[model samples]
Target chain A: MSDSKAEASTVPSQKPVPKIKDISLMKAWKDSKAYREYTLFVQSLNRAVHGLKNSDTVPLSPTLDKLIILLNQLDSFIDQCPPKGRSRFGDAGYRDWHGKLEQESQQLLKDALPEQYHNYIEELNGYLCDSFGNSTRLDYGTGHELAFALFMLCLCKIEALTEQDSRAMVLKLFSRYIDLCRKLQRTYYLEPAGSKGQWCLDDYQFLPFLWGSSQLTDDGPIEPKQAIDERFYRDLSNDYLYLGAVKYINEVKTGPFFEHSSTLYDISNVAHWSKLNQGMVKMYHGEVLDKFPIAQHILFGNLISFDPVPKPTGEGLFKKPAPVANQ
Target chain B: MNENSSSNTNGDIDRWLEWIKDCKYLPETDFKQLCTIISDIFFEESNVQPIFSPVTICGDLHGQYYDVQELFRTGGYPPDTQYIFMGDFVDRGYYSLETLTQLLVFKAKWPDRITLLRGNHESRQVTQVYGFYDECMKKYGNANLWRFCCRLFDLMPIGALIDNEVLCIHGGLSPDIGTIDQMRIIERDQEIPHRGGFCDLMWSDPDDIDWWAISPRGAGWLFGEKPTSQFMHNNQLSLICRAHQLVQEGIKFMFDEHLVTVWSAPNYCYRCGNIAAILAFHTATNHETKLFNAVPDNQRVIPSKTTTPYFL
Candidate 1:
């Protein structure tokens, strides 16, 4: 990391590790190379997961298996740091578990990746550490989920995970990450930081809806309306990320599905999976990426630079909304 | 109670109340009319509207429409049991439109029976960030209803005084406002500003500190027992009742019972697994607490199987 100054002096054009200093620079972030790369990477993975089930056979690289193991090890820490008897919504004992994660995460990342990638651990660990919920607030949200996505993008940028591993990225590593997050949410009773209650998407994650909708695109079995049906989600959950998320919500929350989950209920009214997938991509940009509250916490580094890419002359800064079919 | 309280208006309000009791929202046109009718009633009230004893004081509703119904069932409905709702009527929960509409209709019908004080969430900025703005857009396909609601929120009273002894507000105290008279001088018919007495009254919280401290919420000050006691003593108030933060026990009294936070949204956001309560004052000093849980799934109406709205 100390070499950043020398490298910047030598290259003259390289941006120093990106840090989101304020909300005003968010427009520059939208025009940044990092933002483009991140979204492109996510769309690539989204395409890779199209028409695929979790159970379907796919090659898992050793790097992914080690990362999954790291998540598993972190999961086991929850048992050791069980929530103490407390009256508050967020348990205090989570601070202890988070403390443990902070202490061991760097070493854990070193073990998970090969020696060739050890140099990037300092930058990578920040994303990995923040991927879990906040220790102070004892809550998790789509912002933390964004950290994990950027972590994956960093892996791809560093070539630790090749283009061939894109399918396994969402199907395996990301799936395992979701499981760990759900466990943390339940065991620790993490609050939904800055949640819009039932009006927003699900309390914790939004990627599953994005990538999950992609899995259902075109030849996928279920339609948008049928996704909420218990008969479909119950059996297909293990096989589909979208159903798994839907099933998870149904388990925790009480009340009618449409009422408590009005946003998804409205989304359920969409006719086709492809249209839903397109809308979800748009939603992720509007809700998660463009939002100042969520984006403020995002870290820009050597891997994810904040320097904007120069636009072609006469191009509009704001692009028109992508047209949807059957609107 | 006022000149607008005609028999026809009462009948319309009664019908709206009945319709909302089923958890249905008034149409946009009807909702606009309700907001207009109630804004006029609210405009005539002072910043700290005077309320009588034997009224029920409740906390944040947060769009939990069913739990609000449960709250009424537990504490008795308005007119029978006068209510002073200390703000936070929308956001977080599923039915913001239905929930706020019911309270507004009740206020329109029996303006004298209920005191609807504004909460922090009532502001245009806060509601847009929260669920109320989105809920409005989703329900009506536009933000017109949300806009009308925000205008109504601006005109709503800030605090209520129970026989001039207990001060009921949405959030907590402001250092700039030491007396209740200062509150009255505030021109509160606009968006809540970034700072000042008006903003602090709705955004501030009570913390374990000595005097005024910067609040983590970024807008308000976190005043300790010293400020609380001083404000109460200055205003000759016996108690300060507010509802901005969540209380797992439904009601929490702090600083030796000088201030209390009554949270009426149970199992907040459908997951906190907390109880809700309301304080029923027989007199200004003596009150009974009624605790209630979230409305069970079976008790609430599940939507009937209907035709699919979308087709490929």
Candidate 2:
């Protein structure tokens, strides 16, 4: 899974991974406004992702440039170490690989974030560290991926990322993060944590399709049949986010497009990309955010607001608990 | 609802042997009959039923009909070998309706030999959310079959005990269920509740924590050594056998061998890279554990992409 695109000797500085900052020292994030901030965060990301519909020839931004370089460094980093444990499951080698990332995560975040936001690096390192994958389980899922998404949103919250950079973030950094995660999945053979089989949007990803679909919201009409033409998807991917994701889907899954990826298959048949994009967002909220097992392990820090909403204590106010996927 | 109900007097379940063995679907009529027969039998059993020794204990089929057949064949099929399945008979896999039909038929055919307890996925609402409800629609062209299966799940037991020595359940311990008898009066024949003991029995996982904590799964509580030890000791059982979490080796032992998790679906969802296992608890003789890997030749046919999504 080593990317030939990333050259050797691109390692970051030889410094050890930084210590975690005490987030408790920050003002209590559990205040009522925390949920509002969460809503605002999602709203901002929605606008940012939706904004990509108008972008075609915009010049690339600096934040995107730094993220691309960081991805390359991480890309080369994987090539340096060989996998250590069993062939398929329970690979001990991924532990060392992730540990190396953990050790360098603080440095990696510092290198990825713009210089103006460098001072907040200590506070932000915890989420950045959690964004990769769990070494103990040796798996990646929507949970870890959500961590990374929230990590990026934290960058935005701190003004490290801004509305101006949103379009480029999706086009470059977010897409690149998807690429890195894909490489990790294939190279390390990471398990799809609590996969719901083909019922899910994609085995290892949901954000790409969500953001990607938003990017295609204004692009006239899309037919489900168009998704079957792999070559067509590959040709159009460099220009469209949705096509890029479909291209990646084609690369990973086998069998028919409709068979292995029914959710996306259904999306293709929708009347318009705008409706498809809207549906994707709701699906994320329902299947990913609202689901307990995925949301349970999620840590609420200063940026994401570590507040637990007190349960409503009356009839008809029930939260649907997450069933163990695939039993 | 279907007005006519029949008892399991006809040995009609034996008729579906070829369909299940060939990995084919049961006719819708035969499926309704099977569901009716099993529901009648389960309606008589308590929430915490009793089982004798020398039975094969299996866990979490997860709609893997092929693995279900594999386990039965490996364990020396039917009346000769008693089988106890610890819930999760549907969802995720392609042949959920077909697989579940086999278990219902067997329970009807050999009422004394087969025991099927309800797992979390057995509920009507869960099936509607997961693949079973969709698979039934795709295969049978209606939700009638799905409705029958849900009715059967409502009547199913929540847990079972073998020779009063081992307690078997789908998930793990719950605070509400102390004596096995306590579960008896909590009500049955309704959809599983969203919270309380009924939900916990089907959702919780055993963790390494000291006391009961909120389960990450949210529906069930995460119990540590204290609760497990107390549960087994209070019940006067040597071990608590369960299935819910995916164990890479197919079975995992935690908390000083007092709690065992046996996952019977190998290569879960056809991609989990896991193996399946069954516990052979023979009290008449010595206790034994049997493990099996998923069939290497197992074939999965992808559901059609052209199928439109159904929003409920």
> Would you list the clashing residue pairs of candidate 2?
A84-A93, A258-B305
Candidate 2 per-residue lDDT, tens place, B1-312, comes to 233433334545656865677777888888887777677789899888888988888988888776787788777687999988999989876567778888877777788898999899998767865668767876788999888888888899988889887888999888998877777787878899989888998999887699899864558898999988887778787888899878878788889988889889876766666778888877833567777766544254444445344321
Error of 2 at A280 (Å): 6.6
TM-score of chain A of 1: 0.89
Q: Lowest-lDDT window of 10 residues in candidate 2 chain A?
A: A1-10
Model 2 deviation from the true structure expressed as Cα RMSD, one decimal place: 10.9
Error of 2 at A25 (Å): 32
Docking class of 2: incorrect
Model 1 C-alpha RMSD to native: 4.9
Off by over 4 Å in 2: A1-58, A68-168, A182-195, A210-327, B1-17, B26-30, B124-130, B134-148, B193-195, B207-214, B224-229, B254-257, B297-305, B310-312
Model 1 lDDT tens row, A1-327: 123233323432222243666788889889886787677777878878888888778878899889999999999999989898655557878899999998999899989999977777888888888898888778899999999999998787676886667788898999999999999998888878778766667888999989998888655678888899898777899888999999999888877776778678777878788888888888889888888878888887767777676567423321222232223
Using lDDT, give the best candidate's number: 1
